[model samples]
Target: MGKALIEKGQIYRNEEAWELFSNLITEITPSKVFVIADENTNKHCLPYFLKKINFEKSPEIITIPAGEIEKNISTCLKVWEILSDKGADRTSLIINLGGGVVTDLGGFVASTFKRGLRFINVPTSLLAMVDASVGGKNGVDLGHIKNQIGVINLPEMVILDTAFLETLPSEHITSGLAEMLKHGIIQSEAYWKRIKNINRENKVELNTLIWDSIEIKKAIVAKDPFEKNLRKTLNYGHTLGHAIESYFLENPNKKTLLHGESVAAGIILATYISKDLYGFPENKLQDISESMFKHFPKQTFSKKDIEAIINLLIFDKKNRNGKVLFVLLEDIGRHKTDCVVSNKLIFRAFEYYKNF
Candidate 1:
């Protein structure tokens, strides 16, 4: 008999991730395959992947609109309908292809379809590969809330292809960079140094960096798969980052913030507050902000708008009881989790961003 294969049943990463995916799928050989993607990934990523993989059969391709706004029950229902029409059954498999939005919605769709089915993630963006691709955490945004509804269904495999990143716009590339920066802050100084030097003009080296970021996430998630402990540290920039994203999502007239852009702003605000309240030091905060300024330009928000965003944060899923908890920085590569900050400090965070 062939040697017994050991399946860790968790996330995997490498430059050859796509090749690994092709091999794994060939071994499993599901009856039917579904490839879920957003409009952007369909145009730039899916065609290349189809040509590379030796699928037992041609997979049904389903595409959804690309953006946070499209991540909802409406889209989820459409994906379900597509799976139904394609005769998707328990024996079928789903391969989610795209950014965080695609993985989030596609995972939700796969988890709920006929109770559940095995799915794989071929995360194409840096943000998705680093953060969203690792955790079993999957969900869709609610009205104004980001990731309000979700499930925890780990993928059968995750294919991390940096080749797809070559097609990403500079803005999208920088957006994903914010998450990498966040991961470095929360995980390792060595990683932070590696990321601090990445430039918008450098496109050939993203594949290696993306894998490093994914490895950071894997170490954290493997230790706290359900997000009950150290995993909360991953929210380093997301507390305020999520609020920023929702605020822009609500106000159509204002410039829309990409997931990483909002997080970049969130990191700046959080670090400033960390200095003000937690003795993190003003110099450290300034250094972080200055580095981020290279990629994310400072966005102006009115005091009223800032307060409104904080108000929405009160309803965040991360909050315990009525108080909103912040993952504050002590310094880069270090964070204090579940630290409760007062409205005064929260307002101060906004004040800092105003000047920043």
Candidate 2:
């Protein structure tokens, strides 16, 4: 039996995952089924997925362009049109088989189309497996901003298969590690230590860490499903991270960064801020910065670039009463939410990042 992550959804893993998924299809007996994948997963993951389960009828394949840039209202409109034309109703089921972009956009489309269609998230990337797919927070970017238009609707189930990670690039694997690292920083020091020493070549260890990361997220979401308090801690690195990601994404001159790469940078900056404001201990701060830099190469930002990134912070979803709020740390596993930081201090943090 699959373990329930929330009241509405359960997580199925590895050998048991396929058997449970097959059972689910029989139980739902949806009017029609749709499989949504980006170009990459369509080529790499869909074939394996199709072979594992037998659908009553052939699933309609909806392929979207791959990459973060393709996650938007325009893409959502295209998916919605496809769903409408293909006769997807409330009784239909959608299997989102890809990374965060596909899972997020597909979930949103399923939630909105015909006032909600049953959906399952088959997260193929490391980023999706541990974070995006597990959370039930689904949405797409608005312009250059991250996750601006979205919903907090749970999927019917989440199928996590580590086999799909073999299809990802090493950099992408590193990208996923950032969130796992964040899980450690905000939740457990032992987890942080274990994650910091991860040897990617060790498959058994890697899979165990992945499950552990999911449990950490599950515990947090269970307590604060609406992000009223404890759940806000999950955004520790994302506040500044999203801004940095948006800036690079919108700038033609700079190389666009993977979501985790930017978050790694955000974690470092936030740690510096935490140390300065709440006495979060400089030694741990140094440790975090060093570990992050080890996995993610430093991204250079000119003064003008930094300014634009700072400007994008105003659009962050965590803002309250027109004020930008952040989730900062007092120590490992100790966090404070909705804190304010001055521009001068932010600038100083950037200087620290640049110099380090």
The prediction achieving the highest lDDT against the true structure is 2
Give lDDT tens digits, candidate 1, residues 75-108. Answer: 9999899889888999899989999999988989
| Count of backbone clashes, every candidate in sequence | 0, 0
Model 1 TM-score is 0.94
lDDT of candidates 1 onward, in order: 0.82, 0.91
Candidate 2 lDDT, tens digit per residue, 39-95?
999999999999888887899999999999999999999999999998888899999
Cα deviation at 132, candidate 1, in Å, is 1.0
Off by over 4 Å in 1: 1-16, 200-205
Error of 2 at 201 (Å): 0.7
Q: List the residue pairs that clash in candidate 1.
A: none
The local distance difference test score of model 2 is: 0.91
